[model samples]
Target: MTADPKSSPLFSFGVPALFVWLWSTGFIGAKYGLPYAEPFTLLLIRMLLTLVLLGVLARLLKARWPGWRGAGHLAVTGLLVHGCYLGGVYYAIQGGMPSGIISLIVGLQPLVTSAVAIMVLNEKVSVRQWLGLVLGLVGVCLVLLEKFGLNDTSGGFPAWTLIWAALSLGGISLGTVYQKRRGTGADLVSGTIIQYMAAASFFAVGAFAFETREVEWALPLVLSMAWLVFGVSIGAILLLMWLIRRGAASQVASLFYLVPPVTALEAFILFDERLGLLAMAGGCLSIAGVAMVVMRPPPVNKQ
Candidate 1:
């Protein structure tokens, strides 16, 4: 059987790098947009715009809409992946959790996903894969340590907010497995449209109930929202779903280990954030760990 076009070689080498680059910009986008609007408010706008833009693209491409069952599955996955996960992170950050601390906490998603995949998806994980997960985690922690050290967080962050961050990690972890298990064969463009619509509803409720819904309407905020809507939300997510469909859930989750380091680099270039030698070493370790998981040995056939 041939691989789906979405799962072809283009994804093998190029997609991961492009996805990482696009995904990393999400941090930058949040940084730019958050000052102008409340967390849920900002997310609501981004989700709405993402829906509109993707809807247009889906029509232009004449994308096939999933049946009701697939649409429901995708919507639920969207709630977890986009709504709960992003809501937690944004809320935690808005409530004063440092971005570095949040990133470190969320970086644990691979291990969580691996554990869940083992139990729920009945996936067999090798010792090498476990080692890669741990190594990647350690690498991320080291990079965060250099950037944050013990002093990364100040005193005022609420315990509940940290819990929210953890919830975000869980959301994404479970969402990946759910996507793989239930959403493997869905149409990308239309499925994503349903997802954003569902996610937008989630955030819209929060924005209306909890937020004052004020937006500064600054050029920076507008630009950030545009990038997030078209670039990260659409581009990065399509790549993510493609990866999940193409590889093991654990391996797909491992890719997230690259995010913090990549984001660190982006911050360095864009915002002049520090990227010390220790951070570089940690980044290398992260890469090596991802390789171990992603580049598994081919199956040996016994005649």
Candidate 2:
């Protein structure tokens, strides 16, 4: 008998929603987590804790590890996606690039991923998806222009911040394509442990070399660390891995397009940041682009 499709309906759609929610909350978690520990140091701790918890969870579920075969690929994936991408983002935020602007910058990831996929994955993207990508790019520019005035509060997007943001976006885009290029079917839990461990190594070196990271052990700091370990490292990363395994990488990444608006909402409530209607308009554009791209039919096989 023909086996059930890999992406059964119940799990497939729900995965994206979970990915969005886990990722959305992570922005706030980062805001809380990074202030206490240095950026690279915090990431190392998160990655370290992520692997530990993933191992336990995997053992509980008896999830089979992919063994050494997938190790190198997972290592490279983690270095690019988590290590470089998050390292840059955290560095930028540490320099006072507002989370909204950070969102706008990193939020363009879906469009960038599409471009990389075209070259790397040889994925067929329809003209409609192309238009959606264009819209997303325009939306990102609008959000940046409207909110992050040319001269930001913190030294007007230092040269390093701009370059780091670009590299971060590139890392994420390349990671998306790489994941597709490598193909997915390995056990998600086992795969994530490898990825986190890889990221942990990169960040550990960064932490030891560059950062003072002499953080005092306070109750709030310790609590924030726990939240980040659970919320972002374990929750967001695992959901992302599962989604990539189950569906189109680009389609899975569309949910990340929601991160900008969700982050804005959280910023407003938590940080007392203002997001005017114009900013919200840009958010709507991003949401529209995501809808257009993800719902489009897959490319047909040529006769």
Candidate 3:
């Protein structure tokens, strides 16, 4: 009999690695696409495209739809996760907050998620996990310290933009805990479609109210949009939902700490960006911290 691929070590490692890689590309995609469209407009388009694709997939797979109560939970998650989180991110970037600063701000997610999970889900976090969370934050700060400049106006973004970043941090943190608490066990495809529908509605309202809704239709924008819709939205999000279903919320949130480091490496390879020694060390620390947080303790031997 064939072994279940999902039970293999490779599958376990590969899924998280793939998720981090895909999630990191979102920063690149936002940078690429934002020049051609306002944040809301760009996100609205992406969400609509994602919804269409997921809708088709759900139909083909005969995916089950959750009851209204379960769907309401999914919609709340969608608003918090996709709507507020992505909206804040894209808005901050569009308003000229450097992606590094934004990433650093949101990198606090694991800690925030742990706290929320404790209060909301009644999840117990050991002292080791708390240390790991702190270590991860320190590592992310080290990775991004070079990007900070007191004298640079580019670094001195408007106070409102910083609020957006804060909102984003809160959004994703709460959303992660909320998903673990209430959004699990639904059909992944159908649940995501509902989530995207909520997020799309959010973007539609924002786009109509705030943006001119003009799109330049350039090659970079087109490619970035395609990648965000297919790669990040569909692929990474499904993986995230699956991960959240299968793990402790705090452990799952720790995966986000790897994003900035992975994003730095991606920038280096794709854009000739240089990584300093501190950044490399920070990456190592982040990896170690995540390992500490996510690694299961060895089973105790019976006497």
Q: Count the backbone clashes (under 3 Å) in each candidate.
A: 0, 0, 0
Question: For candidate 3, lDDT tens digit of each residue in 234-253?
Answer: 99999999999999999999
lDDT of 1: 0.89
| CA lDDT, every model vs. true structure | 0.89, 0.75, 0.92
Q: What's the CA RMSD for each of the models?
A: 2.2, 3.3, 1.6
lDDT per residue (tens digit) for residues 19-105 in model 1:
888988898899889999999999998988888888889989999988899999999999989998999888988888888888988
Which residue window of length 10 is worst by lDDT in model 1? 148-157
**TM-score winner among the candidates?**
3
Model 3: residues with Cα > 4 Å off, grouped in runs = 1-5, 147-155
TM-score of 3: 0.96
Error of 3 at 158 (Å): 0.9
- Return the clash pairs for model 2, or none: none
Candidate 2: which stretches are off by over 4 Å? 1-13, 150-155, 297-303
lDDT for position 171 in model 3: 91
TM-score of 2: 0.88
Error of 2 at 178 (Å): 1.2
Candidate 1: pairs in clash? none
Q: What is the lDDT of candidate 2?
A: 0.75
